[model samples]
Target: MKITSDLKYLIIAVIAVFLVVNLSGCGENPTEMQNQPTPYELPDIPGFPKNLNIPADNPMTVEGVELGRYLFYDGRLAGSSHPDSMMTCATCHVQKNAFEAGIDNPRFPGGKTRGLPSAEYPEGKETPHYMLPLFNLVYNHNGYLWNGWVSEENQKLGSEAYGVPAEEPFNFRNLESLVWMTIEAPHEVNGDIEKSVRMIESIDKYPPMFEKAFGTPEVNIDRMSKAIAQFLRSIVSYNSKFHRYLRQEATLSEAELRGHNLFFSEEADCFHCHGGSILMTTNEYFNNAKDSVFNEERDRFVVTGDPLDIGAYKAPSLLNIELTAPYMHDGRFKNLDEVIDFYSEGLVYSEYVHPLMKNVREGGVQLSDQEKEDLKAFLLALTDHQMVNDPAYSKPSDLP
Candidate 1:
């Protein structure tokens, strides 16, 4: 039978439909899509609080933590592979120094951390403050950084200061934000995020790591930061002699016991700021009479713009205080003796001085030298030798 014009048109329509259906890939199998990465089970840490503040976007994963471990120690996190230009998160945070750059650091003397040499800051750039120890970070739900700048509620889409991508809003949430910030900060990595992503992607091993951790071989700052944050959160230090005493696994000496009492009593007034079960820090900002006058540009005022917050800084955890000397925000005190002496008789009253410092009017708590020695012994009990030498937190030997 001869086909008419109407029949011919119908045939053409059927052929077009078939072609479109096949080209659209509707026949492709679901197996071709990437498999979801396995969720990581976080270890139960002693004395840690029940409720954690992990971000909904980036849950912990074993592969992710492993990837973060490599990134945390690799100098390329700064977007450079050159030996002379190398700098990593580990650059300022050494494992032996309780993850803080201690005063004995030969490279950055006085425990003042510096980043890779940059044209804007030649001869390397020094961080405004001393490095905070990297332990019990998972407990820091209130915020990160000394001034409590990188907080949960304060995180936003982009900052001209950091050049965060606009499309990725709310990227800077929790410890993850710190990773990106450090990469861009002049006094930290002095790196560009786009460049960092590119450098990491170029590494043959990293793409597979990304796949294992994030279910894709793609590389980006978000993934990098999340992985690094995972590794950071995994760093817990609760095996100290003090922690052991609490667990009934060990005992403190007579002097240590006396110092412990003094630290928690009205006579010492240290527990109000540095006391807690899991972490020694209350994780709150305080002035602590560092100076009577404060610089609005510096101190907690820079972040909050609140006059009362002038000179206020985070009370760092004393978990590994012995290994983390010289102490304080600027690494001013050389040892525990100097630190105790300052608190004993060096407090200068200020309007913003934390009310916890009830003895500020008396210059300080005024502990006798003997008492000072006792206090030092107790603080030393907080040192966790195992944490400093933990093989898990160390740099991977395979990496060049």
Candidate 2:
């Protein structure tokens, strides 16, 4: 094959096009493609529901996620005496206990020199409003917290959802500041979050993380949050005994199968609120199954000023519902049965109750004791024993 001038030029043109497509990524912005989260796969993630919504800026990658994971467990996010804060993301969300509060404790141990479950019950309400679990958050995006105050999707855009208004105009100068707030929030990591700004500015390890992840030495608030968000996006849990049964990889017992059917059926009415493969939330707002907020407006409403949005809270994912308890926004129901019974008998008939509520003011859906037991069995199936103690996610003892 003798190469003529025309043929050689043609070959070079084709190579150029291929290299362009490979480099800039199909003619679209590399950042745009990076922002979208990867979809959840089933055989791999048994209960895998769907791909999480990744913001255009905070794409998930192995190195970024690993750094975020370390930052998540690092108590330095929380403000303490130089480093004695003892409160990391794991501080409240204890990993072994399914990223929830400790046993016998209804809430996490930090926050609130004067905390209250609701403003109405201000006396000794020091317990946390809810101890958030770290499961399926990649699916929910910013829907992790109980009250759902900070509305960052995969942690970007702004706390103000598109149509939502920002009560405090300059609330977030950028995403990094908000990242600071997430850790600083007493309920979250009890410390001054901005302190991280000065420290990271001086540290060598953090600078490179920012450079590789965000392509800059300027690690602002949004960049910080984006890096943290990468680790969060990586913490998706879907494998479980029940999930395996669903995928036909494992055998489900007679009771487990029966419970499964009842879960989706109308008699249990559980499907309306706790439906889909995730088995708890559908990434929308709900007015509590049989629960209520003392001051509906004061809770999340303080953040999002929609009047009709009173008493509404994000639907929590049911991945590790067994371990993450006392349940509900107020932590009112102590156990699953108490939670079930609240739906069964204690549901307060109110105009504001979640329209999905089976036991809505229309006398609500009624489930017998046996049916309740069956539903509880189904909920237990959602638990993942492998996740609670994943060595990859446990605390790093070597870190000081």
Best by lDDT: 1
Candidate 2 per-residue C-alpha lDDT over 1-400 given as tens digits, one digit per residue, 9 for 90 to 100? 7999999999999999999888776556665455433432322454555655565555676656666676677666554435433455655667765777644544433211222122443342343466557666666644445556555523333333222233332144322334555554433443443566665556666776666555556655556666666666666566667766767778766766777788777766666666754546676666663544355443555556765456777677777788877777667667888877776667675556656775566444577777777778877888888877777677656555
Q: How many residue pairs clash in each candidate?
A: 1, 8
Assess candidate 2 and give its TM-score to the true structure.
0.74
Model 2, residue pairs in steric clash: 79-191, 175-221, 175-222, 176-221, 176-222, 177-221, 358-365, 359-364
Candidate 2, residue 325: CA error in Å? 0.6
TM-score of each: 0.89, 0.74
Output candidate 2 Cα RMSD: 6.6
RMSD of each: 8.4, 6.6
lDDT, each prediction: 0.84, 0.60
- Model 2 regions lying over 4 Å from their true place: 1-51, 79-83, 102-128, 141-144, 152-178, 200-220, 289-294, 298-308, 361-364
Residue-pair clash count for candidate 1: 1
